[model samples]
Target chain A: MSTAPNRTGAVADGGPGRAPARAARPAPTPARRALRRARTWLPGLLLVSPSILLIGVFVYGMIGWNTNLALSDKHAPIQEGEFVGLANFIALWQEARWPAAVGNAVVFTVVFVGGALFLGWLLGLLLDKGIRGEPVFRTLFLAPMAVSFIATGVVWRWLMNPAPAERATGLNALFVRFNLDFLVNDWWTAPDFGMAAMALPAIWQLAGYIMALFLAGFRGVPEELREAARVDGCSEWGVYRHVVMPQLRPVLLSAVIILGHMSLKVFDLIIAIAGQQIIADVPAVYMWAMVFEVRDPAKGATIASYLLFAVALFVIPYLVWTVRKERSEGR
Target chain B: MSVQSASGRVTAPGGRAAGTTRRGQTVKFVVLLALAVLFLLPMYVLLVTGFKPFAEATAARAWSLPQTWSGEGWAAAWEALSSGLRNSLMVAVPSAVVSAVLGSMNGFVMARWRFPGADTVFTLFLFGMFIPYQAVMIPLQQMLVGAGLMGGLFPLILAHTVYGIPICTLIFRNYYASIPQTLIEAARVDGAGMLRTYASVVLPVSAPAFAVTLIWQFTSAWNDFLFAVFLTGPNSWPVTVQLNNVAGSMVVPYNQQMAAAVLASLPTLVVYLLLGRYFMRGLMAGALKG
Candidate 1:
C-alpha cells in the first residue's frame, strides 16, 4: 500500500500527464528495476487483499452458492440435495403465498417509494424556501432516518390499532376524537391492504431521509438560474418547475434507485409489524419463514434468488452507470 | 416622477413578490409545522408513555399526557433490554471501527494508486453493497456453523463488518478523491512511502470521513434486525431483536413496549440528534447520494 500510493503520487506529481518527457534519461538495470517496481506494489496489494478476500467469500461466493441452491432442491439444512433444474423456480409460480407476497411487495414498494419521494420533494422544496426555523423543521424531518424500522413498526402497530370506531387507539383514536369517523379504518387489519397500511410507518421512517436527499439535490441547482428566471418575470412556481425540477432529474433518479432497492428487499419492517403473516408477506419475510420456520431451503433459496434478481434490476443498471461515469472521469 | 412611481399606484415586482412571499411563507410554515407535529406525534407518544404508569397507559387516551411521571416502565424495559443493548454495542462498535479502517485502506489504494484492474476491484467491492442480506443468510449461517463461529456475537460483527465494506469504501474513495494529489506527491518527494505518508498525512486528514463512516456503520449495525435475528439467537440478540421480543412478550404491557422501543431507538436517536450534521453528511456521502 505504501509503495504503490507513493509511486502513483510521484507519477502524478512529476511524471507522465502534466509535463513533457525529459530529454535526459538514465538507464537502470532492467531486472532490478522490474523487481523494485513490483516491490512498490506490495503494500497496496497487501492492504487491499484482505477486503477483496472477505467480499469475495462473503458476498460473491455466497451469492453464487445461493444461485446454485436455487437450482437444486435442498430441503434438509445440513444434508446436500441434488440439482432439480429450475423445478423450485417453477414451483414458486404455483404457490399462492409466493404470488401474494409478490403482489404485496409491489404495493408496498410503489407506495413507499412514491410516498417518500413525494413527501421528500415537498419538504425539500419547503426547506429551499428559506423560511424561519429552517433548522428546527429540518431536524424534525430528518431525525427519523436514524430510527430502526422495528422501533418504527412497533410504534406504528400500536398507532394503527384496528379497533373499530370509538373503541380505537393509535391513529383511529384521533379520528374518533375529532369526529372524523369516516377517515378511520382497520389499518393493517383490513383484508388485502394491511401491507399497504404497513407502508405508512415505512414511509414515516424514510421520508425524512428522502427529503434530505432531495434537499441536497435542490440545493445543488445554481442560485443564479432561479434568480435569472425570476428576473425574466417567472413566478416562484415557474422557477421551481423549470429551473429547479429539471436540474434535479439526476437526484430523482438516484432517489428512485436507492429507495427502489430498499423497498424491494425490505424485511424487518414487515416482520416487525406483522410477524410473517400471510396478508402482509413480502419475499424477504416469506423466504425467512420458508428457511427457518418450514425448513424448506429449496423454496427459500428460490425466493431469495428472485429477491436478488429484483435487487439487480435496480442495482445493475446503477452500478453500470456509476462505473462508466468513473471510467470516463478517470480518462 | 422620472420613474413614474408617483403618477399612479405602481407595484415593483420585487416588492409585490416579497409581500406575496411573506404570506406564502406563513402558509408554508403552518403546513410544515402541522406535518412536523404529525411526524413527531409517535415519537412523542413513545417518550411520554415510557414515563406513564401501566394503568394510565392502558386506560387513558394514547395521545394523552402522562398524569404522573413514572419510571416503572423504564425499569422493566431496562431489565429486559440491558443485555441486548450490551450485545448491540459489542457488535456495533468493533464492526464500525474495523470496517472504517479497512475501508480507508481499500479506498486509498483505489483512489490514489493507479494499478491494473483497480477499478474492477472497486466495482466488485461496490457490488457487495447491493446484494440483499436475505439472499446470503442461509449460506452465511451454514458457513458460520461450519466455521464453528455460529451462535455468537462474532458472526454478527463479521457480517456487519463485511457488508459494511462496500459503503465504507465508497465514502472513503469519494472523500480521498477530493484530497489534493499534491499532498501525496509532497510526501513522496520527502522520501515517504505509502504507509509513511498515509500514517502521517492521510490519517490525520481523514477525521471527517472517519466520523461519517463510523457514524454510518454504527447506525446501520445498531438498527440491523435481519442479521441479528438470523446470525445470532436470543442470547446474543441486539437491541432491535430483543426489543421485538419485548414487544411480543405474552403479557404485553403497552408502557413497557413503549419503553423498550425508546431504549432500542435511543442509541441511534441520540447519535443522530447530537451528531446530526455528521449523520446527514454521511448519508449524502454514502448511500443517499443523489
Candidate 2:
C-alpha cells in the first residue's frame, strides 16, 4: 500500500519537473525568479510577524517606557512629570533604604549562588558515579524545583523561626533539643548575617536544579575520554579532578549565571519568608514597595532600571555569546 | 542503570553500569541519601503540619507525625483557595496554549524559511526571555491598565503569553531546527502550500515538543506570584497569592496555610513526577541555548 503512491508518483512526474524543482527554478525569467525568491520570505515573516510585533510593543517598548519613567520625576502612573535626569538617581544615593537593599542583594547573591553551585556540583559528582536507585534519588532531589518559591518560603519561614530559650520553634527547636543551643539564632534577623540565613530557602529551591544541570554535564562527558584517561594511569579521583571537573566549567558557568540573575531579582521568596521588612529587603522587594506600597513611582522606576541594568550586565553578555555562537555555527 | 548485589549492598551506577566497589561507596550513598532526605524535609513538615489540628500544629513538636489527624485544615484551605485555583487554571491554561501555538508558528518559520533580519527578529524575541518582570512592571501595568484590562485575568494572560514568547520560541525553534530541511522541501515539491505543509508534515510530529512547551509554560504560569500579585486584583488572585494571604492571617492559620501550600504545589509536582524527563529537557534547553 505504501509503495503504491511512490510507484505512481515516480512514473507520473518523470520529466523536466525534477530538474527545475531541484534547482528551485521557475519561469526562467529573472523577474519571476526574484518574485519566487521574495515569496519564500513572506510565509516565514507572516508566521512570525505577530509575535515580533507584539513582543516589540510589550517587552522592548515597555522597557523603553520604563527607562523614560525612571528619568522623570513621576510618582504615580498616568501622571506627567518634568524630565528630571538623574534626580531620582541622586536621591537614591542619599536614601539609606535603597543602598541597604542593594547590600542585602549583594550578600544574598554571593552566598546563595555560591552555595547552590557548590552543593549542586557535589551532588552531581555523587550521582554521576553509578549508584543504585539513581532515578529515585534524582527525583527526590529535584522535587523542590517543581514547587513555587512562594510555597517554599512559607514553609522555610516556619522552619527558621527565631526564638530564644526552650520556647524555640522550627529549626531553632532542634538546636535546643540537641543541646547545640549556641547554634540557635534569629535567621534573617541576625543582623549583617541575616541575608545569609535569608538565602537558605533560595538555595534549597534551586540547588536541585543546578545539580540536574551539572549531572547532565557530567553524563555528557564521553565515556571514552574517561577510559582514555584511565589507560594513561590516572586514578579515579585524579581522572575526575583533571578530566571531568575541567569539562564541567561550562555547566558551572551556566549555573552561576542562572543563580546570579535569580538572586538579584529575588522577590517572592523573601516576601514569603520574611514579609516586606527592610532587614530582608533585596532590590526587587524594595522596588515593589516603592512602587505599590510607598507610592513613589519615580524611585521605583529608578530602582527597577538599576536592577534591570545590573541583570543586563549578567545577561546581555550571554545573549551576545548565544547570538555569536548561533551565527558562527550557521544554524 | 545501577548494579546492585544480591543483598542490595552493591556498588557502581548510572551512565556506567557494573564498575567497581570503591572503598567508601556505601558511606557515600548513605550521606547522599541522607542529604536528599533533608532536602525533602520541609515538604514533610508542610504535610505533617497540615494534617494535624491547630493546637498540635502550633504547640506540638514540629517533626512528629500528626497525633490526631483531621481534614479540617484541608477543608479550610480548599475554601480559601478554591476560587483562586479556578482563576489560576483559567489564566495559565489559555496562556500556555496560546504561547505554544504562537511559538510553534514562530519557530517553524524561523527555522525553516528565514529571510533577511530574521535572526534579528528572533533575537528580539529571545531578549524577552531574560527581561526580569520587575524591570517592566511599572510601565506594563500602566499600559495594560490604560487599556482597561487591569484587575482581571486578561492582563495576566497577556503578560504571561508575551513574556512566554521568547522561551516558547527558543524551545520550538530548537525542536523544529532538528527536522530535516528535506522534509519541508519535499512538501514544497508537492502541491502543498506553506500552511498546508505545516499542518500535514510539521504539526503532526510536534506532539512531544508541544508537551514540553505546554508543561513548561503551564508550570511557570501556575507558579507565578509576582505577575499575579501585581497585575490582577483580589478578584482574580491565583493560588500563590492566596497562600501568602492565608499565611498572613492575624489569627495565624498555620495548618491551613500548610495545606494550601501543598494544594498549590500539587499540579506542578504531579507534572514533574510524571513527565520529569521532559521538564528537565526543557530546563536544559533554555539554559544551554541561552
Candidate 3:
C-alpha cells in the first residue's frame, strides 16, 4: 500500500528535496493564472448575478424608459410613439394641480421631517435619563413603528372623517372639545388646513420610527461625556445642547433623510384619509387619478415622472452623502 | 463602574441614583407615563372600536365602550379581510425569503471576492436604494405589462425583491465585513470550497444578522401598499389594498375596519416584539454612525 502511486507520492512529497523539486517543475503562464482567477471569481459572480440582473433591468432600465415616456405624447394603448419633446413636461408644469402637489409635497416633507425629528429627539432624551419602566415605555412608543401604514392611515381617516355623528375619541374629539370643528369639516375643505389634516396621520405613524432611530443614537453617546458635563455644573439643557446634540447630529441627519425620502413617496396615508375625491394637492394622488380614475397612462406617466424627480431631489443628496461618508470611513 | 460621591452622597457617575434622585426620578416617571398614554391613544381607540358593534362604533361617542361586548366586528372583518391577508402573506413571505437569501449571498461574494466590476456593481445597487420607488413605478409597471406579468402576484414579488435588494445587500455586506477574514483563509487552507465555507462557518455566526434581515424584510413586504396597488388586481390584492378600499369607501363599517386594521397589523407587531432586542442591535450595527 505504501508503494502505491498516491501513497508513494504523498510520502515523497513530505521530503523537502522531492517537494521543492516537484513544486519547481513548472509555474503557470500569465494566461493560465488569469484563467484561474476567473475560475475563482465565477462562483461569486454567479451568486450575485440575480440581484444585479434584476436591479439593472428593472430599476435602472425602467428609469430610462420612464424618462422617455415622460417626454412623449403617447396616451392609452400607446402607438408608435411620436417624439413630442417636452410637451408632457410643459403640460405637467401648466396644470393647476401639479404646482399644488409640489407645494404640498414640500410642506409635508419639511413639517413631517422636522416635527418627527424634534419630538423623537425629545423622547429619546427622556428615555436616556434612566427613567423607570424603560422597556415598557420604549415598547409603547415603538408599537406604532410596528403598525402598518395601512392601519395607521385607516384609523386616522376614521378619526379625520367629517361626519360629526361619527366623530369618535382621539384627535377628532379633542378638536371638537376645543371648538375646533374645523378638524371634521373646514380642515379638509380649506386648502391651507387640508394639507395639515393629510399630514397629521403620517406624522403620527412615522414619529415613533424617528424616535427609535434617535434612541439608538442616544445609546451610542458615551455616558462619561454626559457625566463630565453634569459634573461641570452644566444644566440639563446645556448638557444636551453641548454634549449630546453634537454627537447626535449625524443620526439626526440620517433620520431626516430617511423620513424625507419616505415623505416624498407618500401616497397611501393621504388616499386613506382624504380619499381620491377630496385631496388633490398630492402629486401621487393626482397620478393615481390620471392612471386609474381617468385611464390616461401617458399623463399618469408624466405625473409619476415628476414625482420621481422629486424623490430623486431628496434621495440623491443623501446617497451622495452616504457614499462619501462610507468612503471616508474607509469601507 | 466607578461610584462617584456627589454632595456627600455616593452614586454611580451616570446612573440615576435611588433616594437622592427621587424628585428627578418621579418627575421623569410621570412625564414618561403621560407620554406613553398619549402615544398609545390611537391604538387604544382602534382596539375599542374593533370590539364594539357597528352601531356603537358609529355613534357620536364611539370611543366609549359598547352597551354589550360583541365579536360581530371581528367575525365580519375576519370574513371580509381573510383573502387580503392571504394575498399579503403570499407576496410578503416569498419576497422576504428570496430577498434575504439572494442579498446574503450577494453580500458574501462582495465581501470575500475581489472581482473587476464588483465595486461598480455594488455602487449601482446602492443607486437603486436612492432612486425613489415612485420614480421607477411607472416604468416598472410598463415593463411588467410588456412581459405579461402585470396584475399578478409575480410582478409584485419581483418588484419587491428588486426594491428590497439594495437595503438587504447593504445590511449583510456591512455585517460580513465585520467578520474576520482569518476564518475564510483558515477554511481555504483546510481545503474547504466557497459553498462549504459559507454554509459551515459564515452562516453559523450570522444568525443575528439573518434574524434582523428576515424580520425587517417580512414587516416591510407585509406592510407595503404602493406597489401592491399598481401591480396586482383586486383578487390578488394584499391586506393594505383591502384596508385602503374599506377605509376609502363611504359606507364602510368603522368597527369592522378597525378590527381589520388590528388583525392586519398584529403579526408584524408580534414579530417585532419577539425579536425586539436583536432588531435594535441589527439596526444599530448598520452604517448608521456615519
Q: Write the per-residue lDDT of candidate 2 for residues A21-76, one digit (tens) a residue.
A: 44543335667645555555666677788898989888888889889888998877
Clashing residue pairs in candidate 3 (N, C-alpha, C atoms within 3 angstroms): none
Docking class of 2: medium
Sorting all predicted structures by DockQ, with the top scorer first, yields 2, 3, 1
Interface RMSD of 1: 6.0
The superposed Cα distance between candidate 3 and the true structure at residue B233, in angstroms, equals 1.1
What candidate 3 gets wrong by more than 4 Å, as runs, is A1-42, A164-170, A174-185, A231-233, A278-280, B1-21, B281-290
Give TM-score values for chain A, per-prediction.
0.89, 0.90, 0.83
Query: What are the per-residue Cα lDDT tens digits for candidate 1 across A1-331?
Result: 3234524322222322322332234564777556556555666777899999999999999988888888987887767789999999988989688898899999999998999999988998777746668789989888888989889988888888887775678888888788899989988867867777878998898888878888777777766777788888888799888888999887888788888888999888887788867778889999998878898877888999999998888788788787777667662
By descending TM-score, how would the candidates be arranged?
2, 1, 3
Query: What local distance difference test score does each model get?
Result: 0.82, 0.82, 0.72
Candidate 1 local Cα displacement, residue A273, angstroms: 1.1
Best candidate, DockQ: 2
| DockQ of model 2 vs. true complex | 0.49
TM-score between model 1 and native: 0.92
Task: Return the TM-score for chain B, candidate 2.
Answer: 0.92
TM-score of each: 0.92, 0.93, 0.88
Better of 2 and 3 by DockQ: 2
**Across residues A74-193, which tens digit of lDDT does each residue of candidate 3 receive?**
776556567788788888778677887888877777777777777777788777655556778777777777777778988876666555524435566667767776654644545776
Lowest-sum lDDT 10-residue window in model 3 chain B: B1-10
**On a 0 to 100 scale, what is the lDDT of residue A120 in model 2?**
89
